[model samples]
Target: MASLVLTDGSQLTSDSQHLGMYSSPTASLVLTDSSQLTSDSQHLGMYSSPVASLVLTDGSQLTSDSQHLGIYSSPVASLVLTDISQLTYDSQHLADWCPLGKDTYFRKFEIYSMAWQNEINLDNVVLAAASYGGPVAVVRDRKRFIKVQTTGKPVISIYTASGRQMSSIVWTGGQIIHLGWSSTEDLLCVQNDGCVLAYDMFGTYLHTFGMGQEAKDTNIIEAKIFASVNGTGVVVLTSSYRFFLVNNVKEPKVRQLAEVAGLTVPPSSWCVISEDRHTRVLMARGSDLYLLKHSEQHAFPVGLDLRENTKSVVEMAVSHNNRHVALFTDLGHLWIGSADMRKKYCEFDTKCPSRPRQLVWCGTEAVVGHWDTVLLVVNRQGEFINYSYDSPVHLLPEMDGVRVLSAFTHEMIQKVPLVVQQIFRINSTEPGSYLLEASKQFQKRSHRSDEYIRLVKDQLNVAVRQCIDAAGYEFDPSNQMMLIRAAQFGKSFVPDIDSEPYVKMCRTLRVLNAGNNHTENLTCGAWCGLVKFGNFWYN
Candidate 1:
């Protein structure tokens, strides 16, 4: 053995007999016997005799063999293993967490613009359209429609399922700016100038509410878009800062709500009624978000305080469950708040392009139309599931798959490292306690996927063995005899007798074949025995 003291007072001592070595002030020490040394950083007995030890300047040491470096540092400074996972063999159990797996949660949508200026042959164009229920509506009587209207002019039109124009209403008006349908398909509201024209489902004009009169002789300063709930009345906000709620059925109800003074609402500003028509929310030019309770006509101050910053609120929608409200700004940031406008949950950046024209929550996912180049689908947790939809596509299936994956991704971001430390840092003394904790996590992860379950089961089995070994317990014939009973109550990932892992685990338990009285793969009798073993272990 040789001992050396470095100029800096760090020392190394190795049980390496007569080993010739050299050292520098900054670099590591070099040694012979194919083992290199320099600093006295290596403690006595540092070398394993079969190989040489590497001593570093700061008293750290490394044991080198032909294949691996058993690194050990004296006064260890937080040893960081770089990509230890890659260094280990590809564990069948760990393969379930694929690093390059697809994202879960988001789905994309295709955008097709129906012609705003096109002339359809009268032979193809129909008239008098109506939607009965759901998103589908119908157009009828093509020839009679042509005679009643001017040829080749865009007037009133209903969009078809294929995104084509199903019908057009012939009119002298310049254009129809906005359209909305009622829940019962009984009425369609169209906005033009200062008037909101209500039509019966069959194209009969029911009523026209004049906004200028409602605002009391004020000039029609701007046209705020209107949203009408199917069974509820139409919600209208005028540029004159006047708002009105008008229901035009057999029982007509009109209520004049609060008005904003001295504020000019741009044409792009819009008001949307809640799905139940009991509430309405509006966004104006200054980024001011306002909520109104229609039932009581009481304004609830949301205090979003987002006005005058010049950022537009691009999209706003109530959640399907009607329990949440989601609003997206022009900056690709999503904000979620309570449906009742009470609390805001989270706001975070997204990969969606700024200034997306539309945001649609399609069931499990949200789709954003980012100009013509990209479509982004995002889940509530903000994972991009699918994109680049340029053709006829069904996005729901892909969204479902991504949502499942997001659950796993979330767990990885939150749990995996702690689990590894918990398992590997255990003492050789109390294996049973560690075994119990590992089992719980394993079962929880098992539901993530089939591959995940397999991986977890493998780790759990390993931990079980180590725990038994640490406690100095062994599975002998007597215990083996009762293994079948234990397994009956035992926690097992094995459900099939044909699976290799199941067979191996059963063999470990030494479960005997009750019918033949011979050791074999799990039959029904073996399973019963295994359950009992599980009960024994668990208890």
Candidate 2:
């Protein structure tokens, strides 16, 4: 007797003396046996015929019972066994806090286990993630070779940050140059011909706009989506070395920016900075940097007093707040300074001449650069930390931090809040730490609770505040609960302490935690709506 186990936990058993099986092109089968399957010379125990496809996924076994004949496959049959290491739960917690400078700490933590692990290769796709923990969009890169059954039009898929697929659409548009998310959570698809297509979260087509007649004639070679004072803005660089800007996607009035004079080729690096209710473009042409403003008819140079040995700028990234900018040069040096170029923070040499795959700010505190597998985070003072990944990763800059997306996991790296560091940092003694210890001991009904409480007796109010604030920053429910309990324990010892902040934090944490678990509830649009409601309520 022989048995066949399928992927869906179904089993097939054969009672005949000779067991033979065949699978179609779409079917899968697995055979397990400790001994050899002995069959007559005219019969075979298992035989896969022409055009049969057999796949062995993880934890599957295939063995022959008999030395005479165990399993046989025809020349047309395809047998494939995939070997992939299963990720452990402990891998998610491997990321820890690293101190950025004197008082600040940065942490990277896994937010979601990706859903498209085997379905999509991140290296071969164009990815865009919306801010405020919104949905992620992916489309296959047309230039890259991907193995697929069909050669038809590519499919665009939308997924939540946690990797749950939301929607997919058969893209019938022109060649896509870029994919980005707007401030309103609309997916923007930029085509090479300067047409921008907008789609809602569910992949429903909203509207389309064009850059300009000039852009269409010249052809858009590169594009950037940035947050402007008005709304989500788009700026495209044409092949003719010109730029076009639209301050808001909802009302895309294409305006040609002042051209970079004395430039015959595309700039090495460029970025958009939105400030003071206006948007400006900054571009690097060799060792020279130019600032192009829509209001000005000519581009003007922004002076950077570089050493004579400095090379041309290759990449630039602006902070989320638009207050700082980081520039990378061919000499392997990273320059951090104010956005206006008046103040210089520090210049650090990474000694890596190859341009990074992605360079963006991690919140307002550090500049993060990612190559193929190495991630480096450099602070304003030139302090740095390095992280290594085995797979291709993408970086999405957010208001508070940056989201790191890999095929297997989604993670957030950001500066840890001071309140959390005060309580959780390995320390000699912080009042909040003592308060936490007191709360734990009180739960155990130990006399040590009184000792811990007395240690922070004079600063019970401060300890309570710290615990409450720290609870608000923590993502873990257990940590939040323990901190809240610590706050409650300390609050009782303080006389006439206002309970408003603690109560408000509790309500906010409940809402935030629920949104974290159900990511669909806390998107950029949902957050904007909440802010509007809060304003109305306050008024």
Candidate 3:
């Protein structure tokens, strides 16, 4: 008997010998014998010998050595076999990890290669990406001149995080100031006149709202869109330096915040902070900071002991949880402190006078600052890591991490989860590491698999739990399957272990993996449907 392997959606046919067929990881195999075709994992079709023919049109059949055949039918069933050799080594996943503090680590990895790399120019457009791996919207920046001349109206294009274009429309409204997405994934186009036009994902107009009469009269200077307790919120700063806030775009009830006293000019920088069930405005005036609230009659200055040479707070970002704040000053001093301004974490100097083009928080662990081509991540202890990109990048902060969107690629930079560190950290003695090793050796049919399994036999359940948890954090499908397979292997040794987590994780991964393929076409509601279907089928 001869063994044949099929991968990368290839086909194999042999009429001379009885063959044992296998499909490699992340690939599909198709085989035809005597005009009978069988499909298995992820479009995997296999034929056993020339003596027996198996035909599967709406159903699948498997034959054993005794010639016993079993038939299974599912309208939406798909299987994907895992090849351990294709699984990324722990070293590769660990390579990107950078230590944040004594125990914490962060890593940056590419998520998707932009599908619009050749069509869209990041330099000529203003882009905004939604949180939670949502769609991105981009429109031409009228202020930025491109070599090619075009019509007066620019087209607003919406794309998935993978850069697949969903829909686009020609701009026929007022001068656009910013492009953002609501919590429900609607496109919010903030115009210069303080009017925001909302559009669905398919570029259909939904509704519009205005900031206030004063904002429209004065003309909006700048605006910030933030996630609020109620929903997506927008705060606009008028040319007259007054601020207006709408805590929920869906409701669109605009309120004016307290005026910053003695402020005749625009502050160095400003941000919207949603705290204590109310949204407030925080602005930097020279070296002084003021927190403006809608309930208060006047804006109050936040006292801080600054260095004598400190000139201004150039940039600031509040963490996802609104628990920590990072403020960058004119003298290149970066300050990390509690959101309430009660406790100081640390202050580090970047030694660069130029203000960063974009400053945002990566989860609650670090502050990320992006210049033209330099991307920097600074932790609380002042330890920093910087990467230089060939082109400018946009940062979209998420609940767990930040998405770095560039002209050609989409990436994620975030603090590594502890479960992932336990399994992949170099020279780790954790039980999960042994279980992973055991899995790899088991695939190779090596006797060392037994030894590795024995080493962690006492803690098998712990190892299995770690693998399952780590698999949830991994973005790569192949890596996820690897960890999952290790957990499944470990579960076999623990007969009394609860299988709910393993089953749930497997179903969730399948749905997510399927969803990844059609992100451009699927909405949040569609995703929920897929998840519900998965749950129903599993139940």
lDDT scores for all predictions? 0.37, 0.75, 0.74
Tens digits of per-residue lDDT, candidate 1, 257-327, equal: 65444446442344454555454655544455666544454554446733234376766655433456567
- Give the CA lDDT, 0 to 100, for residue 299 in model 1: 52
Overall local distance difference test of candidate 3: 0.74
**Residue 477 error, candidate 1, Å:** 58
Report the lDDT tens digits of candidate 2 across residue range 1-539. Answer: 12345222122334322223332233334433212333321232234333333443332234221111112232222334332222222011213777788977888887777767887688898899887678889888878886878888989999887787889878998889889998778999999999999999889999999999999998999999999878899999999999999999998999888988778988999999999888899999998999998989999899996656876899999998899999999888899999999899999899897898999998888999998999999999999998999999999887667889899988888887766666655432678867876786688687868977888899998899989877766666776788898899898887799999888878776766666664453432122223224211110
Scored against the true structure, residue 220 in model 1 reaches a CA lDDT of 42
Candidate 2 backbone overlaps, count: 5
In model 3, which runs have C-alpha deviations exceeding 4 angstroms? 1-91, 518-539
Task: In angstroms, give how far residue 324 of model 2 lies from its true place.
Answer: 0.7
- lDDT by residue for model 3 (109-130), tens: 8877888888787878899876
Q: Give Cα distance to truth, residue 20, candidate 3, Å.
A: 41
lDDT at position 450, candidate 2: 92
- In the predicted model 2, the residue pairs found to clash are 35-65, 36-65, 36-66, 37-65, 37-66
